[model samples]
Target chain A: MMTATRTKNTTTVELEGDRVVVIARTFRAPPRHVFDAWTKPELVARWWAPKSHGVTVKSIDADVEIGGRYRYVLSHGDNEFAFSGEYVEIDRPGRLVYTQVFEAFPDQPTTITVTFEEEDGLTRMVSREVYASAEARTAALESGMESGMRETMDQLDELVAELAAG
Target chain B: MVETFAALAEPNRFRIVELLRSGPRPVNTIGERLALRQPQVSKHLKVLKAAGLVEVEPRAQQRFYALRPEPLRRLDDWLDRYRQLWDERFDAMDEVLEELTQKEDEG
Candidate 1:
């Protein structure tokens, strides 16, 4: 088990044998802005990628449909990271389920489920990822998932404020 | 991500990625640039093809290999869980900077 603190949130990542669960929450922005910042490609690019990396989207095609496909890329300096997937379910402005394939390993794919809820105008988004194997999931969590997320959520808080103010 | 990473793990595979970084190119051209034997390059390409990291376009008898970005999108989706973390941290930093600037203004 490992614990990390963001600007105003506490995150705990625990490895239960091989299954890893990461839970974090921040208190400072409205849920709508957070959700919008997530769903919008432009807003996403601003705060996407790790703190030391810049993400350049080669293309973005999202319809927000149940069977729609979303594809994009992220570059960390000179290295390019590719990913794409089809939406299994979409309850817009609320929840989403999709399969993500990492360009690095085409044979391995993971499923991501996200939910957004409003509390006093602040949005709480929770994401759960299930991998094909326990070892694979552990590899992901150990591979900078905590530090990467700490930086991303921090940027997200700012993006929400900026979009709202704009 | 395994296939893409595995493809990138090899020196030759990394060469291919570096080439595509500028833009897509023909496999023959890529082979020439890397000085790799045509058969060897084709074999490496076979692995990449199975990974969906590279796409092939046929023009008559010749084929062109282009970096298709769909797989990267899949990686990004998985990485999206961290998007909020960076946003929150940067947002706080901005607040600290703003407060400092405001104090300077008051002074």
Candidate 2:
């Protein structure tokens, strides 16, 4: 019996052989629509990240194919933040595995896997983000990762509704 | 994590906490108000205890459960950060949508 219990939807953020894992889930309209929202740069701009003192994207480039690369730069006036990576696997309208790096702050790239499942026409999207070190994981968590993910999911919901309406 | 939330997520647990917000109450009184069996009330109390959201104190021979409020306060604090993000994003979306609608009207 564990004495300490974490809150709801609080991902088991712990060390995995020197790395950290962050897991989250979001619900949307459909798998294809959610996948498109993630893969398309224009739509990604709408919700790809969060607002930390206000983050505006400088540029976004994404190639949906496996082995393809994607990159984006987020800035707050003079402060800059960049993330770039490549797709290791792409299972059309269902699953995706990609690597991510923060160019402004050099560190090992994180491998992110997203799975989409459809139930009653609503898509359930789950993402597992693996970082290089426990320190890096803690840093990411402290850097508003939870809030960022939640906002992104909210954005996804809006995008889904727009796509469904159109 | 699920266990922590599942404990308090029930409507009966919510009612129990709401009742305790005024002050501590005996387990039997809580069970009566909730129309729940003593064993059932005890189960929910155990969960709330594990979550550190409630505590029991002995007043005479009977035990009284009281609201801690700290865990719920932490939850609100954690959600506040995300709430701000959603509010800002929605504001931006409103602007974009307005512009799109204006363009359609002009066309």
Give the DockQ-based CAPRI class for model 2: incorrect
- Give all TM-scores, in the order shown: 0.48, 0.51
| lDDT by residue for model 1 (A1-166), tens | 2156545554333222233343444434555455555556655555444344333445445655788877656544455556677789877667778777665565657777777787775556666665656546634533434443454644433222211101
Task: Report lDDT per candidate.
Answer: 0.57, 0.60
* Candidate 1 deviant stretches above 4 angstroms: A1-7, A14-17, A53-60, A145-166, B1-107
Best by lDDT: 2
**lDDT of residue B56 for candidate 1:** 84
TM-score of 1: 0.48
For residues A20-135, write the lDDT of model 2, one tens digit per residue.
34343343245766677667788667754444445566778888788898877665556545678889999978998998876634456677887889888656666667776555
In model 2, the runs with Cα more than 4 Å from the true position are: A1-23, A49-52, A145-166, B1-107
Cα lDDT tens digits, model 1, B22-79, are 7767777888999998888889888888889888888777788878788666555544
Fnat by candidate, in order: 0.03, 0.03
Give model 2's TM-score versus the native structure: 0.51
Clashing pairs in 2: none
Error of 1 at A56 (Å): 5.6
Highest DockQ against the true fold, candidate: 2
